[model samples]
Each structure stands twice: as C-alpha cells, then as structure tokens.
Target: MSEKYLIGVDGSEQSRVALAWGLARATERGADVELLHVADDSFLSESVAFLSEAQKASEQMLNAEIEYARSLGFTGKITGNAVVGHPIAELEEASRSADLLVLGAHSGSRLAGSFFGTRAVKAAATAHCPVAVIPNNDANPNAAVVVGVDGSEASKKAIAFAAEEASFRGLALVAVYAWMPPLTPGLEYLWSEELVDSQRSAAEEAIAIGVAGLATRYPDLEIRREIVQAPPVAALVQAAEGAELVVVGSRGRGGLSRLLLGSVSHGVLQALPCPVIVTRA
Candidate 1:
C-alpha cells in the first residue's frame, strides 16, 4: 500500500493546531503532508485592493506552515498550495486523492458554527475518503483508538479500518457499543431493573461479537471493548476524552431507510475532542 496522505487546512488558530497534529502523525506514519489554504473570492469581494493583499498574506501563511512542519523534524516532502474558490468545494476537490483529511474545530463559537456550519463538517460528510476532525484543546496523551460499532455492514468496515489504524500506530483499539432502553407507550416514568439488565447484557454480547472478528484479524493488536448505556454521540465524546482518534460509520442501518447519515455520527463529529474518521460501507 502507498503511504497515507495527510491534508490540513490553514485558516484559524484551530487550523494551525490541526496542521501541527497532522504533521506529527505524518511524521510517525512516514507519509506525505500537504498544507492547503483556500482563498475564497467571496471573502475578498468587499475590497478590490485588499483582495490582492489578502492573497499574498495567505501565501505567506501557507509557507509558514510548511516551515513549521519542517521544523518539527518531518523529513518527508511537504507541499503547500493556495486555491481560490468556495472553501468546502475546494477542500472536497483536493481531498479526492488524499488518504485522510484533518481539520480543527472552532473554539467557543457554537452558535455561529451551527448557523453557518464550518467547512470541516461539509468536507467530512461529502469526502470520498475518511476525514479526521481534531479539537483545538490540550493534546490527548493516550494513544487509544476508539471506534463506534453498531453491527451494521458499514460499522463492520469501520471496525476493520480502526483495527488496522491501531495496529499501525501501536495503539489500543477500543470498540464501543452504546445502548439505550427501547421506548414504549405509557412507560415514560417507569423504571425497570430487568429492562436495564437486559439492555446491558445485550450490549455486552453485541460488543463481544463485534470485537471477536477484529481480534482474529489483528491478533497482535491490543483490544478493549466498552458497553455504555447512553446515546451513541454522548458516549463517543466521553470515550474520546483520552483517545487519539475516533472512528465511526458514515451511516447506520436505521438511517439507510431514510437515506441519511446517522445523527449520532454527525453529532460526534461536531463535539469530539480528538480526530474522527468516518468509514464508508
């Protein structure tokens, strides 16, 4: 297989951190790293004179990022490019041949991000390959790889991908299954111990089944499984606290009926503390 390609966007401080992380990861993987900065024409239409100046500044920023990557001991060849177009469309086009796309989350801007979602989310949903969203916070120390598995064919593919990543990075693979009580009419205020136990037991059994095949496929990799009783997105964010990377299926079996990506995967991508990888079926 060819060396993985790590692509990072340069826009904000969060993007800078993402570039640093991507550089570190690429160094470890012996992969090529590309730093891209998209100069949207719409962003510069207000001032015709400022447009040229802004483009020059953007080129400088890209050059600085490449120098920073080189300073970090990344001996592999690094390429820096600046393009003019819609940010999301440019990124999606650039990601066509990339092995992985890495992005950073805007810090303390939920409402703005929600009203006008970031380019990262759009690229992740539409990209042909996997996308990794890294948060702009303190770096995670542990090298654990957390993968969300729901027993769907797509999720099984995600599990296989996660296991391969864990093996390659020499990290522990954590397979997580989030389960909740089924909703029934007129049972809103009722608490049933039997129901809780049954759900927990079923979750454990399902996790066992999912991890068994991965364990056999990657015998040398260390694996751990967790059965959490909560929403998949919440459980995944909590599990991502100490994890280096989080993996999830692009869509689930239930969402297939409606031809939509699962809300869980979408939510996790927004709030996850570490990088997230979405695998296709």
Candidate 2:
C-alpha cells in the first residue's frame, strides 16, 4: 500500500472543492497534503510552448492552494510540485506512491456532465491507489458514507477501506447491491415479483458475506445494507445522495464484462454529489 496522503488543486474550480475536502481529510489523519498541478505539455504544446512558464504558473497555483489549506487550520505539512507531462499519466504515476488521489469533477462540461470526464475516467481506470473524485456540490458535514459491493475481491477491499473510514468519522456506512433479472428475450417479460425478491435476497446475502469480516473488525461502526433492482451504475449514483464519501471497487465479478456492461464505479464517480473512492484488489 502507498503512504497516506491527500492531493488537490488540479486547475479547476471543482478541483478547488476537492482540495478543500482533501485538506480536511489530511488534517483529520494528521497526514501531509501534496498540492500538485500537472502541466500537460501535449494539451498546451502549441499554445504555450514555454515549459518553464507553465511550470512556474503551476507552482504559483500550488503555493496559493497550500496557503489556503493552512488558513483552514490544516497544520499538517503541505508540499507543492509541478510536473510537465500528460495529466492522466503523471497523476497515475504519482498515485502509485501516494495513498489517495483526490480530483475535482467539473459540472459545466456537457460531455462530463453526462458521464465521467475524460481525465477523471482515465485516472480512475489507471491509478494504482484509491482515487477520490469530488463533486462541487458536496459541502454538508453529516452526510453518510456509501459503498457498493458485488462479492468480488476488489469490492471486498473497497468495503474494508470504507468501513474504516466510516468508523473513524463516526458516520453510517450504507452498502448497496444492484441486481437485475436475466435479459433473455422471453425471460425478460416473464419477470415476476417473486423472482425479484429472490434476486434481492441473494444480493443481500452476498453483501452480508462481503461485509461480515469488516463488521467484525469494526464492531462499533453503524452500517446499513440495501439491495436494489436496478442497473449497478444507476443504483450507486442514487445511493450517493447526501453522502460525504462514496466507495466502489475498480473491478468486480463482472470482470471484463465491464467493457460491455459498463462500470458502477465510473458512473457513481461521474454523478455523485460527494467524493468517490475507487479501490483496487
């Protein structure tokens, strides 16, 4: 596992919100925060050919973000650095060494507004450590912490991490499991209430098995389980309402099926009201 740290200030307003959240988390953990602004030379290669100028501006922004963090009573040390490369690649490389990578998701881009923005999607897909994608609207303090479990190794790791977070913050952990009836042509229309209930029960049982060990480890942590009959992505996004943090496994039993079925983690990270942590197995 990488060292515990939070990151912020990636040159977007959404990132500023993410920075604030990361700063608060770092303060709580008594850990350091690295304010990084990667200058993607490829993006501005033609517009701003001067690498030094871009680096200098990035450094200045990093310093300002660090100062803001300090003003917010984050006495923990803050380090600022600027690197020139592809934003996604550099961030992924940095995440290999950091405990957590926090990123801000912009709400204005229509492309991103509908799904995980390009940068956030790339980082989440490639990052080695947990990546927290923070939305701009999450400012509440009493929101619950939500996680999605599908009885996979990655989901199990996500549950363990989320349970620890909920225990540490004294917040409720809401575990969600999404189930759907088989899509066979005639079988699809044949769906019945009994089948739905049975599927939901099985999902709940799987969630219980996935969380049993963590619940034992954190006996005092408050947890709630939900089995929803919806697409995994939609179910997780809905559960993220009023949540301070959301956790999801990078890969699940669905496996390479993710390419065709889509990823619940990607969906939640794109639309969630709060930050999302994606854990790898």
Candidate 3:
C-alpha cells in the first residue's frame, strides 16, 4: 500500500496553507492525503440536531478543500474524514496509523503560544509518526533545510530525516549543534579556557557524527555545519531563519521518556520562522 499523510483542516487560513503543503507533498510522493476535520460543539447551541449539523459542516469543509486541491491539479486521492470530538484527541488518534501528521500554525506573539493551546503543538507532542507544522505562508523552495542536533537517539533520527528531505528537495542541509555556557556565581575570572575549548570541541564532534555518511548518499547536495555557543533553542531558531524547513528531534539528549516533547523542541517550535518537522524514534 502507498503511504498516507493525514492533515487537519479547520477552515482557517492557516488550514489552507497546510492543505496546500500536504497536497504538494502527497503529489510529489504519490501518496494519498487524508483530510481531517474535528467539529466541537463547545460554543454552539445545544439543539437536538446540533451534532448532525456539526458533522455535516465538517464534511462539507473537507470536501471543499478536496475540490480546491483538485482545481490546483492534485492527482492523488484526498479522503475526507469528519469527527465530532476534541480536536487534539481525534487528530492524535488518527495520526497513529498515518505516515505523517500535518498541521498549520497561527501567526501571533510567541508569549501567547502556550496559553493558546494550539492544535499543532498538542497533536505533534502525542502523534506516533513524524509531525509537520506548517506556517501560515508558503516556503521558498530554494531555501536550505535545517536540522537540530545533539548526541541523542532522537537527534540521530532527525539527522537522517533532514538529510533525506534535503536530498529530495535538492537543497542544502544545515546541521546545527548548540552549547550553552555555564553560569557561575562571581567566579567568572576563574573560568578555564580549557573548558571553553572542550565545549567547542564537543559541539564539533556532534556535528560530524550527526552528518556522517550523508556525503556519500547525496553527492551533489551541499552540507553546512553550524556550531554556536548559545542556548539550543536560540541557535536552532536563528539557523532556521529564512530556511525552507526546520527538522528537530521530539526529545533531546537528557529529556525524560515520560515527557511528550523535549524543552528544546517545544522552544524551537514556538520561535522558528519556517515550517518544522519534529521527528520521533
């Protein structure tokens, strides 16, 4: 069977961007697209026919997107899925069997990210497969693909995904590793030069390891290595400036297994300027 990509569409403008992104990817990969719409009656009047009306409206919205996709020349099949439940819960359940879960992000202040309870963040945290969060605007195909790296299994997986995606897109791959300087109490003058050197050395080694073997796989692909002495989120987000897509690990080196998403991944998601794909093992 061919791969299937599931995308959430809520009739918002961001949803339109996500729909276009999903269809383009599906068309390129010759994979089918699943259009998911969750209708919550939270604010609707509690009438007898409200449930059916919600379901009908959701299906109609999905079909309209399908028609629009076809008009844009998408040849693959896009199945419509309508569900009545919490958006996050339904999307997470649907993403279990999907090859990828695609979502749209709202353009707003970063401070409102946590309180907004955006569906993209919550669903990406729980999805079994890789989750792609697309921005409100389209991407420039010529821009590079950026991947965050650390000496972790998740980072390794992200590296592989970023490499393959870069090769597929025929764009450069940028591997980024960040080191945070330690804060000491009033002993700044005593800080060792050797410690700084060692930290930079470790970051270099991590970049080399993360990008190992990609040169052979993609001979024509350009690879850029970046090592910055800053917080991981800051470094990765800065590297992702004007990038086509930013790929990151769901969890970092020291993240706990019980945590759905790592701190760095969440931070990058909040601050990144382009679309981000959060990969999991």
Clashes of each: 0, 0, 0
Q: TM-score of the candidate numbered 3?
A: 0.90
When sorted by lDDT, best at the front, the candidate numbers are 3, 2, 1
Among these predictions, the greatest TM-score belongs to: 3
lDDT of 2 by residue, 1-281 (tens): 22466474755667777777888888788777787777668756554558778888778877777777787777777787777767777876787778888877764322153122557766777777788877767355867888888988778888899999999999999998888888897667678889878887889899889779766788888899988889988888788767877888876324463232136666665566567788776
Residue range with the least summed lDDT across 10 consecutive positions in model 1: 108-117
Expressed as tens digits, the lDDT of each residue in 1-281 for candidate 3 is: 98999988777777778778888899888899988888876677777698888888888987887788788788887787887777777876898789999887765335124211355776767777898888775576779999998989889999999999999989999999998767887977766899889889988998898898999989988999999989989888889887999999885323454245778888877764788899985
Per-residue lDDT for 200 in model 1? 85
Candidate 2: regions farther than 4 A off: 1-3, 43-49, 108-117, 189-197, 252-262
RMSD of 2: 3.5
lDDT for each residue of candidate 1 in 1-281, tens digit (9 for 90 to 100):
54556565565667767777778878777788777877767646757677777778779878877777777777887887876667767776787778887777764323126212365666666666777777777766667999997888778878888999999888899999998787778885675787688878888887887777666677789998888888888898899878988899885323342244468777876675677787766
Best by lDDT: 3
Instruction: Name the better of 2 and 3 by lDDT.
Output: 3
